[model samples]
Target chain A: MSDPAAVPPLLDARNIACQRGGRMIFAGVTLTIGAGQSLLVRGPNGAGKSSLLRVLGGLIPCLHGTIDRHAPIALADEHLALDPDNRLEQALAFWARMDGVDRERLDFALHHFRLRELADIPVRMLSTGQRKRAILARTMASGARLWLLDEPGNGLDAASLRGLGDAMAAHLAAGGGIIAASHFDLSHQFGTVVELDRR
Target chain B: MTRWFLPLVRRDLRLAWQGGGLWMPVVFLLLVASLYPFAVGPDARLLAATGGGMLWIAALLAALLPVERLIAPDRDSGIFDQLLMRGISDEMIALVKLIAHWLGFGPPLMLALLPAAALLKLDGAAIMRLELGLLIGTPALAALGVLTASLVAGLRGAGALAGLLILPLAVPILIFGAGSLHPGSGAALKFLSAISLLLVAITPIAAGAALRAGRE
Candidate 1:
């Protein structure tokens, strides 16, 4: 237990196959991500990148095979999933409360994501880039061990991207792992890369 | 580990209030009840006789007013996916939503009944029976509406389909509730309550399964 290197994978998927609206998007996918490690999922559009993440997050059933998740998961997808009518802090607070997060983590996440200044603004009032940042802030404060990031880098500015990188680094340093589906180059290195080729 | 259900319920209530969901049904019920006296030409005896049934019909239709918005908006917005990721099951979500929906319209509908009864010239006894029937029957109405909303949340023609789906399931409550006012049918209230209890119990499971099936 003393050596983090001795830790086993926090997430292990064995031969996962999933279908979306009667099409088998991906098949025979296997991947393992351990504590303090990250997996990069790369594929062209319509290559089942989002589907694979959904399967991993248990939003949809796996058409075949199995998934073993040793810890809780936080997923950030194309949808910011925040109520547009609510203020930025209120919208995030709804999710934070659901995740059983406290005020301190919420403040920390807002600071790290550079959203503290915009906290009082309505979500619908934010720019697309800022809204995405709000979503990332929710994900960071979720206290989940596995982060499933779907196109996390989309709409992020260079500075915000670097901040995301630092957040990922800190998360990994604390024994959490990330599985991200992204077309953009990630600032943090990954221990494993999974390419889901278009069929 | 998720305490989000209460927040979810509170948010839904707040949204419903702001969105006019809370008042739409009440006004709709009032309009339907008020128009009935003119249709029957204001014969006090006949109006009292038929007004109770008219009120029941208005309640049923009013229960349906918000079905189109109940669960579809959240599902379409991918909020359900976020909830599932947090280890909260769809069953719990459906249950919370059902409660929120009932709170949104049920009491308001009961309060609307007072004005509706007066417009129909319902006698004192008829008014008492009507109010009690609504108290027992509105929960069943809410359950059916929520259940139908979950069933057709994402499908084409969902609004019409929900109306079609709910009417048949709701027939038992309708019959028993309206029958409670009839002569020599004191037992109708008990049957109405029994049906309401059954629907309330089944909603969480039925709606939860529908949501899971939708993910396919």
Candidate 2:
């Protein structure tokens, strides 16, 4: 087995700052996560946790920071991101194709999220927790090395929440990393936690 | 990167077709062209003289029909963020969407123009000129539509605002395209082509910037 220390961190961010509409969000934030690890970001509403995730995902520009990403990333924010008109399986498959992942992985992700039976349903018909599961399935199917989740536990049931913990543990065991933002407790304990204060 | 181009275009085309986005504008164009005769009391010479210009105007308005559908839904649904996360640049997304938007409306509008021209009593020569002008001009109209859609994508009342934004930017193309049908206006065709090419070239970059700005 390769020395875990020798593998560079999956994400290396330093002095990261973000702002919106010319207002400062947060500044002087720094964190790093290596393979087989996870980081949890905790904060109240409007504390910029989602914006920070967006910055880390490169979806939005950071006002001041240097970030080095060593692997591909997947994000599951509040946005469902699935095509409303497409069947669940097809919608997930579209992203799988985009990520260069194969059919087997998509099937595995569907089963992983307990969405196999719901695969034929149109995405628009999915209830809130089911939609959240679909988003997580999309992230899982992406085969990316890092996962960025925003409010991942919002609508999950007790059993599904436990399944989420199992999935995170399995991902970490497989050398994938996670950065999730949520005030509620998830199944797995993160290696590190950073709490953001409202500015 | 190149591999994604066709699939994205195909997806967009499918959506446009399924959503009735492809045919609505064609129907709108035909309806407007057919109405011109009733409003003007069909004198053959008058129809022939004004028909080409009326079609150009109708085509411009038709381009506006699907503006609200172009980027707003995808933006609202986080499709843009997902694509961006996959390392697809915003410019590529805009370009693909521009191509798809054109494919959806431009050809159908031209085909619709055939019957519309017949309704307007245009001669064979005039019909050919109108078709040629539209072939050159419709791409610019599509680009303008995509650009405006990107600019106003997340705003309330985006459809009305998109129409307002696209019309003024489209004046040059309209003037040149409509003027090309005038007798001995070969230079007008060249000007139309130039402006069309310019809009197509810049739309992806401009719309891409608009999308990134919208994130903030």
Compared with the true structure, all predictions reach lDDT values of: 0.89, 0.92
Candidate 2 chain A, run of 10 with poorest lDDT:
A1-10
CAPRI rating of model 1: medium
Candidate 1 global CA lDDT score: 0.89
lDDT of 2 by residue, B26-94 (tens): 999889988999999889899989989989999999998889989999999999999999999889999
For model 1, the stretches where C-alpha displacement exceeds 4 angstroms are A2-8
DockQ scores of all models, one per candidate: 0.75, 0.81
TM-scores, all candidates, are 0.96, 0.98
Q: Give the number of the best model, judged by lDDT.
A: 2
lDDT of candidate 2 over A36-135, digit per residue (tens): 9899999999899999999999989998889989999999999998889999998888888888888999899899889999989999999999999999
TM-score of chain B, candidates 1 onward in order: 0.96, 0.98
* Residue-level lDDT tens digits of model 1 in B24-71: 989999999878877889898898888898889889999999999999
